[model samples]
Target: MIIQGFYNIIDKTLALQFAAPDAMKDPFYVDAYNALNHFTGSQIVTEIPLKEMQSYINIATQYASQTYNLQWAFSVMMGMGAAMNFSMAYGRRNITKMKELSGNGFTSTILFSCITAFGVFCIVYPGWNAVFITSQMGSHYNVITEHLCWTYTIPLLAAAPLMFLSYFFMSMLRSEGKMLWVVLMIVSSLLVNCGAGIFFMHVCHLQLSGAMMGTVFAWLVQIIWGLIIVFGVKGSYLKFGWKDMLFLKWQNIVAFMKAGLPNFINNAALVITSFALTTLVVQLPNQSYNNGISILQELYSSITPWMTIVLSAGIGLTQGARSIIAYNYGAKKYNRIWQVLKRVSILIIIWFTLMLVVFICFGGLMMQAFAFPKEYVPQYRWWIVINFMTYPCCAFTYIALTLFQGINKSMLGTFTSSLRTFLVILPLIGIGYAVSMATGNPIYFFVFIGLNDLISSCIIVPILVHYWFKYRQKLVDLPDDFRSTSINEETFKDSLEHLSKTEVTAAKEQTTPPTKKQS
Candidate 1:
């Protein structure tokens, strides 16, 4: 659904007739042509339409807009996919038990994810476009066209890299389990997020752009932190062995790719859908209409930081719970797992409900902070309200999916993830565009955003209920002996060392084959 939403942004650009480059903006048309052809001819226009000029313009415009967004979205999707693959790879079974780990790796992952989400949220909400337009240097200040180009560029620039780094850091921490190093990395990264924001806003006097700058800086901090921990620190588990240092483990890489491939494909598909939705919306008759939609979307984007904080913390804690559940399940301590799940589920439910209430109650005040154009306030008001309304359903979906992850039933988890966007979101978005066009009802547009989630949950909830019952028995089936003991730090170290030695000795003994020569 997120991807679908993104595509809809592109569609809106197309509908607004903003997708095609307005050659009139170019100081030197010839120069513009040459530069475009040289750098991005694949994306730039080549031939003029031969027939039905208006209709052709419309069709071509949508196509170009969709294509442009699709390309960028694909790149971002690939980066995210890479992160997922790397993370799953690093956490493969028997390398290091998630139940027994120390240091900053996981913390760094959480921080990076939260920071990235926060940065993006800051950029999206409180009106970056306004600052963008007003903050332009000298000559471009009065030019709407120039302002449009710059305003549009900021989102793609600010968002894409932050997303990449978030995934990268998280993946690395999960894979390397370099705890202490990751902690330092996260601290530096946080400083980067907080520091950059403060610096840009205060010293540079660049209000929103500062947020973007801070995000980039945070990424740099994380990378450096990771490097320092791996190379400079002694006795760190993250340190590369001689073999790992000298050679890439292609097999391991492939394993991760295989495991995470589904997520990658799904993300890619969703991004494509987002581009499509954007294109469709853009094809509407007026630029103001597209801008209006953009405002609402921006509002949606703004909520991401808080959402990220919630999600990162939620996922991290759930991961810990999941590890416990898996262990207890394996040991056949069925009752304890149930107790744990019950407690965790109740906490999640209560917390999720509280967030929904807070958002709904304070949504107006929250929307006020953005200080959008007065003219658009009426429409924006409903957008915010509807989003708040959908919170419960969305939360339920997320909770259910997370529960699936805990049970090691990742297939269902994947399905839940896919269904949110592909099954529920895309179709609703299409219907919204159709209804708005046919009835000319602007209010109907925002309705689908909430409606889709509500309907999707309606479909998923029953399945989740059935599975919860069927697997409820599996959660607490651990043996009585396993229940009496807690997993400890030394357990993994001793087991790993013992296993490694045993394998090595067995190999040596096999090679020695006593008295084979006599035979």
Candidate 2:
């Protein structure tokens, strides 16, 4: 929190900024990019450590899940797809292949995220009521809902590109253990984000949109600085030509996606499911009897930013372990890999136990950071306690999920995530809605949120362990373009050439037989 002190200040200030008597609730919104952004595997390590970036995946992003439409949804799916591919390439230390992968991943994912944003933006001329505002709050927010959706997508457009490009460098620096440089990049971005945000709000008076402007400025700086440092390093940047991307390598893409795409799917599935679940939870048949769940839900959104502080701390450990695991996996150090897992597990147990205890004790104080209205105190407190009970379950599930991802068992990880999110958790939430409608109790609805975590932990932990044994010593699949791990510009170009080779040349190797000694 101290290292990320700026964001804590920003968020704590936001509670005051938005909650003011003359406060504008609509535009000066918290960062909403997270709804559309799912950083796969190592990007989690890069982006989540700083408080500002972590909150960039803020409560608004989560809350917006229920509000955004299919286009925004698919962008998340593909964005995670891109993130997964980048992390896997780095895990293999496929430096030669990274240029092409980075090019494709950045260009393709940003295009999708931005195009989807523009697609959403285009709807701003109206029709939001029928299309994007399908959430239960749709009726309540009226035109406001549609307007926020339009502006929200703009931030996703700005944020997704910044995050995607930076992840390439963040992944590389992290792999090489250049921790100092990574911190500098992140902190510098935070500073720019703050400076730009304040300037836009105070000087330019862009109001809520100024927040988006601030974010874009910060990320643009990070991207520029990152590229400079990267190209500045002599002999570091991989050599590439336009010819390299002319033809598609279906097999290589498939192979990378096979190991990588699951992380994307798992995350995307969770977001999509959460979006649906949010729609259901906000609209109980007896909603009027309960003092309006939307206000509570909106207020509840504030808690996640603070919760992110704790979650980020826990993830910090998992990410460090992930980097170590990925590097060792590439080196084929099985014993070392197992050791890392064991250490992470022990750490998780200790960390989660302490986290839950702290939350249980001081959780109310944490809520005070949000500066909720006095009347909402009871509702806020109830939500906090219910959320606190699930922290341990959440911690275990995350560590387990990250473990599968780190060693590149992303398919299993994806399977576990999809099952937990779609099949198990959402169904449980559905049941909660059923009970709430039957009993006219909104608390039942929120209790299910905690219950889903428990049920998911029960299911996910077992599946993860089963797969851990199943694939314990197995080798990871290599992309078809993988020639060697050696880092050289000429060899890198040759690697690209290998991708473009004729079918017969790639399929068959040539060699001259040694002359017989007898002859």
Candidate 3:
């Protein structure tokens, strides 16, 4: 929270002081100012009171505050939870069995986490530069060219090592005896990040650049920590063998692609669709809509880092919960598994509901804190409220998808996400663009984004219902004693009673035969 707040303060201070002035006097700024002036037709700049401005800033700050704390905590908690779950699930198994498995739960979690951190920084760095340079140059033109040039490339390069080290820790977590070591590695990396971020990024005046540099430096520290664990740690389970590497199986790669490719496609398509919608919005006659989209994008970027936290924690618990339930079902403990699944499902729903409420209630004030140019505030507020309503639907999908993964029916999970991205989001964007352009109503764009999730829910709810019924039907078809058919208790008791009766008859016959011999 502190690190995030520090960056927020620097960004707000610099953008307002440097960018806003240059933007006002300069023609480019004049053009933007005029465009907004024409659309709003109110002298909003001076008309808005300081009290409102302060209120906006306070709300925006709180949103950033929640996002920063939630994201970091989420990342840490998810990493730890994933590590623990992977250990408990696969730890006791032989290496051969472990190698054959595809999920590599710990590895996937860590890699995505590292990628998320890197992406967050990469995505934020560009916008940060935009804020700074636009403040300095008084326009948004050169920033794009500079982004293509050289200023932002280092952060992208820095992200590579973070991803690699994440892979390594994930591997270590999967290895026979290194849970504690992996925990230490993560802790050490975080400490380095905290110290450097506070000193260099905050105190030393590097701003966003320093923030990126500090994160990269933390990865470097983590890489060293990984090497120490790989080389120095010694134990019976830690016999570092070259054999496994000599014959890396292709099946692992295939399995990962099967499970992950859909998700990748889902996100990539969403990004493309978002870009298209933004372009459409920018083309709108309303300056407020265009400017609103721009600022909202930045606020959205700020909130994205914490998605790792939400997904990580949600995915971890769901994976563990599903596995336990699925195993019991496989062992024919039908009643027990059914009871457990119901309880867990209820808890997950409650948790998701709470998150929805928080984001919806506090979203606007949060966007305001980013302190976008004064002219665009109205549109920004509307979009913030509209954009976050998708959270509940997203959370539900995430948990459901994890459950599908658990049951080895991951295809269904992939399909659900695919439908959400391509079918729901993209189409709604097209409709939004068409409606907004034809009618000259910018609110349609806002309405469309919100409607997409509702549509996604419509599709998803039925599928989930079908899944429940299909599984329920299978349960009803099971035989009464199918659960314990391995030992037939009734048949064994019947055999014992017959055997006793036969023995009594044989004894009576033996006594009669002895009397005839005597005669």
Best by lDDT: 2
Model 3 stretches with alpha carbons more than 4 Å out: 1-92, 99-141, 144-150, 167-188, 198-207, 220-240, 289-344, 373-379, 473-519
Tally clashes: model 2: 2
Instruction: Judge candidate 1 against the unseen true structure and give its global Cα lDDT, from 0 to 1.
Output: 0.46
User: What is residue 238's positional error in candidate 3, in angstroms?
Assistant: 8.1
Give the CA lDDT, 0 to 100, for residue 339 in model 1: 78
TM-score of each: 0.57, 0.72, 0.59
Q: Give the TM-score of candidate 2.
A: 0.72
Candidate 2 lDDT = 0.55
Q: What are the Cα lDDT values of the candidates? A: 0.46, 0.55, 0.47
Pairs that clash in candidate 2:
27-208, 28-208
Cα lDDT of model 3 by residue, 205-323, tens digit: 44334444555566677667765655576532222345543444455434544544444555455445544543454455454422323343344433433333444455445544554
In model 2, which regions exceed 4 Å deviation? 1-95, 118-125, 128-130, 134-138, 145-149, 158-160, 234-257, 285-293, 310-320, 467-519
- RMSD (CA, Å), candidate 2 to true, equals 11.6
Ten contiguous residues minimizing lDDT sum, candidate 2: 18-27
Residue 122 miss distance in model 3 (angstroms): 15
Q: What is the lDDT of residue 221 in candidate 1?
A: 69
Minimum summed lDDT over a 10-residue window in model 1 is located at 48-57
Cα shift from native, residue 203, model 3 (Å): 7.1
Across 363-421, the per-residue lDDT of candidate 2 in tens digits comes to: 66666555444455655576667755765676666667667767777766676656655
